[model samples]
Target: MSKFTLRFNTIAAALALSGLFATNLAVAEDIRVISSGGFAQAYKNLASAYEKSSSDKLISGWGPSMGTTTNAIPVRMARGENIDVVIMVGDSLDTLMKEGKLVAGSKVVLANSLIACAVKTGNAKPDISTVEGLKQAFLQARTVAYSDSASGEYIKHQLMKKLGIAEQMQGKAAQIPATPVGEIIAHGEADFGCQQRSELLPVAGIDIVGLLPQEVQLSTPFSAAIVSGSKVQKNAQALLDFLSSEKNAGVIAETGLEPVAAKK
Candidate 1:
């Protein structure tokens, strides 16, 4: 072949390769995610694994599944922050979908979180194995702390009332906002701390007593959904799939949550 033709073919090949690289770069998106504390630990572990195996990038943020705090996911959505995926309570996700904040049919259950109690690491563990025992534990504690999220709401509105100690707990029990209950207990700000087992596990200087008794247990479903206005819907869906996949069930379970993927 003529040298001119050979040089021209080489140039054409280089252009084609450059175009392919650009397409690949476009396909790998930076997906922004906001995860509630209930699923944060497990999501972090799974996200690390996903990042290692895929070219897509994840930008993570934390907030309560339901709250009016400045950092709350719903409040962030209301402020029109750019987000791609949300990992939060199932009911809260449903509320967002009803409000048209999340894409329809994009919700996926990741795990079930059970309410649990904790105390400072060196403090005596309370007996919460039975309904009455839990009540007594709460009534006896000088000060109690719970999250401002789903588990805290349950403790404040339903569980305490069901235990017939709502009146007694009125002054003693306080809802901790924008912070984990375990942290409160760890700091000795409260004698007893109550929140999702998964949320408690991540905090240091606290000993998780145990899950709430079956009679008064509240099992919250932690779910993930794509934000309605996300520019990277496909990448967001992939992340949700990775989080709820059977392959990640062990990691989810290790974080003190019941993996919904395993149940399926």
Candidate 2:
């Protein structure tokens, strides 16, 4: 072969290999996040944007009681699962901080949630305009539902007792196990169910009633933190920052969660 031809072929091979390397680099790094039902939808939405802007894949592991209000970080830590980031209740994060599971400086409240009620799609939307109306609706519900998670526990301990229906709701009210609380209503197995606003929005076949009245509402702040000794510390922090940004607030609101306002 001619020397000129040999040089051209060698240059072509070098360019092709370099192009392959560049393509691989353009793909994002996959980072695993452990989150509970409350912030799952919001975080998933933020993950899409983060992946596009930063070359890293956001992998989320969702648990019903795993990171939910009642169980929080302790369950995951006990289970010994590999988690890069945790998104759960603020109180739960504080517990982890006490245990040194979450890095101290990395914790941030991403969103706050209010409990809301849901019914099967196409069902008559119950009147929850007033506390009295909500009380009536709860009493009238043939089979009410609530979670065994944080919000559920609150409903049982505080709300029901306050409403004077803890005994009335005893046998008729269904306590959902590990499944999504909204699922029970969506499947027509329960007349009504309550869960975090963010959790109910993503679920299909369920229509959300507005949040509980302010007087009776339960607001649970959802926070995120990088787990201590996480391998992908930078990537996990990026995901948390992205979720906490103003740009992501729209999605957060759409999912039935309110973004934590920036402190002055």
For this target, which candidate reaches the highest lDDT against the unseen true structure? 1
Candidate 2 lDDT over residue span 139-243, tens digit each: 999999888667887888899987888898888887676678788888888988898888888889999988898989999999889888888887777777788
Clashing pairs in 2: 28-55, 28-56, 29-55, 29-56, 29-57
> How many clashing residue pairs appear in each of the predictions shown?
0, 5
Tens digit of lDDT per residue, candidate 1, span 44-128? 8888788876788899999998889998999999999999999999999999999999999999998999999999999988889
Cα lDDT of candidate 1 equals 0.91
RMSD of 2: 5.9
What are the RMSD figures for all models against the true structure? Answer: 2.8, 5.9
Which 10 consecutive residues of model 2 have the lowest summed lDDT?
Answer: 64-73
